[model samples]
Target: MSLQVRIMTPDRIFLNEEAEEIILPTNTGQMGVLKNHAPLITALDIGVMLIRSKNEWTPLALMGGFALVKQNQVTVLVNEAESAETIDPNEVENSFTIAKTKLEQAEGQKQKVEANFVFKRERARYQVIKQAKKM
Candidate 1:
C-alpha cells in the first residue's frame, strides 16, 4: 500500500494524493517517510519537499510549518507552498540572486534574520526548479 499525503497552506490544499515516499526538510534535517512508518511529528523548515510516486520524483517549495505522520498518513501544513511547475525559473533565479545580496549586506540582527529568511525561501524555490529540470 502507498502512503496518503496531504499538503496544505492557509489558502488552500496544495496536494492530496498518494506517494510512495516523501522527503521532508525538517528543522533537524531531511526526514524520509514511507508506508507503515512510525507515527511522529516534525517542524518543517523553509526548504524543498520531495514526493515520489510511480518512481517519479516531484519537488515542492515549502515554507515553515509542521507535519504529522500517523497510520500511513502524512499531513503537512505550511505557511506557503509552490510546485515546481508553477514557478518561473527566471523569476526565481533573479529573486535568489537579490536575496543572496541582501543577506550578505544585512547589518543589524533583525535585518540579518529577515534577509536570511528571504534568502532561504528563495533558495528553496531555486532548488525546486533546478531539481525539476533535472528530472
Candidate 2:
C-alpha cells in the first residue's frame, strides 16, 4: 500500500499525493518512511527529501522545518521547499560561493554563526542540485 504524503511551505502546498516511500532529512539524520510506519514528529534540517513512487524518485530541496507521521500519512512543513526541476544550478553555486566568502570573512561570534547557517543552507542546495542533475 502507498502512503499519503503532503508537503507544505508557508506560501503553498508543495506536494500532496500517494507515495511508495519517502526519505526525510531530519535533524538527527535521514529517516526513511513507508506505509504504516510508526507515528512520529521530528525536526527537519536543510537538506534534500527524496520521494519515491513506482520505483521513480523525486528530489526536493528543503529548508529547516518539521515532519509528522501518523496512520500511514506523512506531512512535511518547511520554511522553504523547491522541486528538482525548479532549482538553478548556477544560482546555487553562486550562493554557495557568497556564503563561503561571508563565513570566511565573518568577524564576531554572531556574524560567524549567521554566516555558517547560510553556508550550510547554500551547501545543501548545491548538493541537491548536483544529485538531481545526475538522475
Q: Which is the leading candidate under lDDT?
A: 1
| lDDT by residue for model 2 (1-135), tens | 789999999999989999999999998999999998999999999988998988888888889899999999999999998876777878889999999999999999999999998997888788788878777
Q: Where is the poorest 10-residue window by lDDT in model 2? A: 81-90
Q: In candidate 1, residue 127 scores what lDDT?
A: 98
Among residues 3 or more apart in sequence or in different chains, the pairs in candidate 1 whose N, CA or C atoms overlap within 3 Å are none
TM-score of 2: 0.92
Determine the C-alpha RMSD for candidate 1 after optimal superposition of all C-alphas.
0.5
lDDT of 1: 0.97
Q: What stretches of model 2 exceed 4 Å from their correct place?
A: none
RMSD of each: 0.5, 1.3
